[model samples]
Target: MITVDEIKRMLPHRYPMLLVDRVTELVPGERASGLKAVTCNEPWYEGMPDTATEEDYHYPWTVLIESWCHVAGVLVTWDRPNPDVRSGKAMLLGGIADAEFHRPVVPGDVVEHHVRLARQVGETYVFEGESLVGKETALTIGRLTMTMRPASDLTAPPVPDPL
Candidate 1:
């Protein structure tokens, strides 16, 4: 088991935004499995009104995908850990394709994301996998691409809104 502390040593993600809670399994340069325990304490739930219904509490799909990506991030960077993006190459999501959500994730759910390295070319990596709640699959990552770029590349000023 990789504690959240260890995960912090691998990825630059931090709390609330640091969706992955712990890594249960990891095969460096190959595959990994990690967990995220959803809870009402999550900042995303703070905006709820007193009238909010059960549907309103379902974990946002965007956050779910982000959580899964964090695990994949751990897998690809395990062999070459770079927690600080200021010094070494940093991993960035290049693309997400064919993702399918199987069920609604609620506050009580514990999601386990399983990620596999499908292929790698130069600094780019292709990963495939799924997330599960209990024994049932919760989401499928049909294809996700990640790339390694020099830390300096990530320092480019944010693009201005076209509006």
Candidate 2:
């Protein structure tokens, strides 16, 4: 199991943005399974009014996908750890497709994300998986791609297009 502190070292994400709680299973460069528990005390829930219902506390899809991707990041960085994305190489999302949300994930729902490497081409890796809450699958990822590129390259001035 990869603890939160260990995950912090493998991933650049932090509080509020760091949604992955713990990784229960990991096979470097192959596959991984992680968990994230949604609580009512999260920052997003702070803005909820007293009149809010259960649906009002539903977890955001963006956060869900990001948390799952963090697990994928761990698999990618297990051997070559890059704690800082500002330098070294950074993992960037190339694509995410066919994300089917089966049901709403609400507060108290512990999401179990199962992700595996679908393919690897050069510095890019494709992942496909699904997330579940107990027996119900919440989201099915048809394909998710991540590419590693130097941070400097990303921030460097773009080349001018000569017409």
Candidate 3:
């Protein structure tokens, strides 16, 4: 089991963006399971109007996907010592394919992310997993790929003025 503090040390995320709360199970290069407690106090829920519809109030799918990716990040870097702690490198989400959302996730949900490392080729890691709320699968990810590289490599060049 890994505490939130330990998770913080391993991941680059912070408040509001740091999704994974605890890691209950992990196997260095094979698989992992993590938990994320969603609450109404989240930043995404701050401005939600009382008159909002269920669709409008539902937790964003993008954030849900990110939460899963964060867990995958921890699993991939498990064997390394403080892999993301102030390191100039970062794990980038290369791509996501075949994602399907089956149920809506709300504030009171405790999301359980289960991930399995399918394979690794060079610096790229491929993963397959699902996010569950209780016994129901909330989301299924058929393929999620991540690549580790220097953070500087992702910096975009300044845009030129309009012609």
Candidate 4:
């Protein structure tokens, strides 16, 4: 099992961008299961200076997709034996297909993300990932294609206090 503190070693994303909270299961070229605990303190909640309430805070669809991508990236990295020594790679979101959102995700939700490698051709890894809030599915079967970049690209500092 990989906790949020451990995930920081593999990815350079910091607070507000670092999405995955914990990685429970990982299998190389197979599948991975990740956990994310959403909270009211999420930086996205703070809007402009005039914002009085969070009712207007909207979680963009693109950001949600990015979260999914982060899950997939963690799976791939954790699959390796020595993730720390590795230069740290970047998974570019090539594309997303057959994506459907059933409901909105609010604060105080523990979302489980399951990502499996559906197939791989050349450098592209095709994966099927979904997000669930308890028993209810927030996202359905969706396809994601990501291309790996050299591990040297992760130059940013580690994410802090997001668990």
The models' CA-based lDDT, in order, is 0.85, 0.85, 0.83, 0.71
* lDDT at position 46, candidate 2: 88
Per-residue lDDT tens digits for candidate 2, residues 1-163, read: 8998898788877788888899999987789999999888988788798999887888888878988898888888877878787876778888888988888899889999999998888788889998999999998899988888788888763322111
Candidate 4 C-alpha lDDT tens digits along 1-163: 8888788766667777888888888887899888888776778666446745455544555666677777788766654522433554555666778888876776777888889988777656788978888998878656887766556654643222111
TM-score of 2: 0.91
lDDT for each residue of candidate 3 in 39-121, tens digit (9 for 90 to 100): 88989988888998878767899999999998998897666634453454677777788899999999889999999999888
- By TM-score, the best candidate is 2
* Model 2 worst lDDT run, 10 consecutive residues: 154-163
lDDT of 3: 0.83
List the pairs of residues colliding in candidate 3: none
| Alpha-carbon RMSD of each model | 4.4, 4.0, 5.6, 7.2
* Candidate 1: clashing pairs of residues: none
lDDT, residue 104, candidate 1:
88
Q: What is the TM-score of candidate 1?
A: 0.90
Give the winner by lDDT: 3 or 4.
3
Q: What total of clashing residue pairs does each candidate reach?
A: 0, 0, 0, 1
The model with the greater TM-score, 1 or 3, is 1
**lDDT (Cα, 0-100) at 67 in candidate 1:** 94
